[model samples]
Target: DVKRGKWEAPELLKEAKSFINKHKDSNTKIGKLRYMAVEDKASGTGLIQSISKQTTLPIRAIQRSTDKLSRTMDVILYVEERRVWLPANAPWLLNYIEEIEGLTADWTHDHDDQWDPTIDAINDSLAKKPTVFD
Candidate 1:
């Protein structure tokens, strides 16, 4: 051989490129479980507790599931302005969460204007004071 022709310049010198923009083919089991955790209109902060109660799973196990889901969706749920925010990209998903899960969009739990439980207490007191219907 004139120059030891074992490799070519293009093959040996070129560096391979990686494209990571594309996500996985489908959602993982843990991801789906995490979505369902919030599907019951559970509180954003109390997601772990709610999921634990609903699924009867230990906190550690639920935490593992939550970890998996957080990787996919950062803002799982939120509350703000005395309202909750929900995760819904498709009409079907929104309806499913509403009708099947009996949950509404309550994603504002982590907003600057946090929901105040005291307001609900005040409303409750007012409600019990004396209603014209009563």
Candidate 2:
């Protein structure tokens, strides 16, 4: 089954990357991917809050690490969503997102959407715009 479904993984990753690249300044894409990477972990959920609780790494440090990696890498891993996105130009970021997603998926199967305060703020800000992309 793993071999037969092998193509599915790449396809999913391609789709996820396309989705992320298509929407410039998409808060959902940014938040979801970052959240998944940081929150989805084995010993601890890779979530920002979880990371903050379990380690001395400050939330800002986690955020900065993710941001710096995204800026320098080709792919960004959204582990919670079990997908990876290619950052249009930066191929390095693609693997980063994939790593995060892999770590997140390994920890659990329940991909339920959790309440995100950041998403709410982003949504509110987006609502004021003529369009989310614009």
TM-score of 2: 0.20
lDDT of 2: 0.34
Using TM-score as the measure, the top candidate is: 2
Query: lDDT of each prediction vs. the true structure?
Result: 0.28, 0.34
For model 1 the TM-score comes to 0.16
Can you write out model 1's per-residue Cα lDDT over 10-126, one digit (the tens) per residue?
A: 332121000111112234532321222111222333444433454332333112234322321332222223233234454444433333243224432222111122222233333
| Residue-wise C-alpha lDDT for candidate 2, range 1-134, written one tens digit per residue | 00111224345344434443444245564453232222232322323343345433233311222432332232222323434223465544454435434444234523212212222223333323575775
What is the total number of backbone clashes in candidate 2?
Answer: 25
Q: Which stretches of candidate 2 lie over 4 Å from their true place?
A: 1-8, 25-39, 42-134
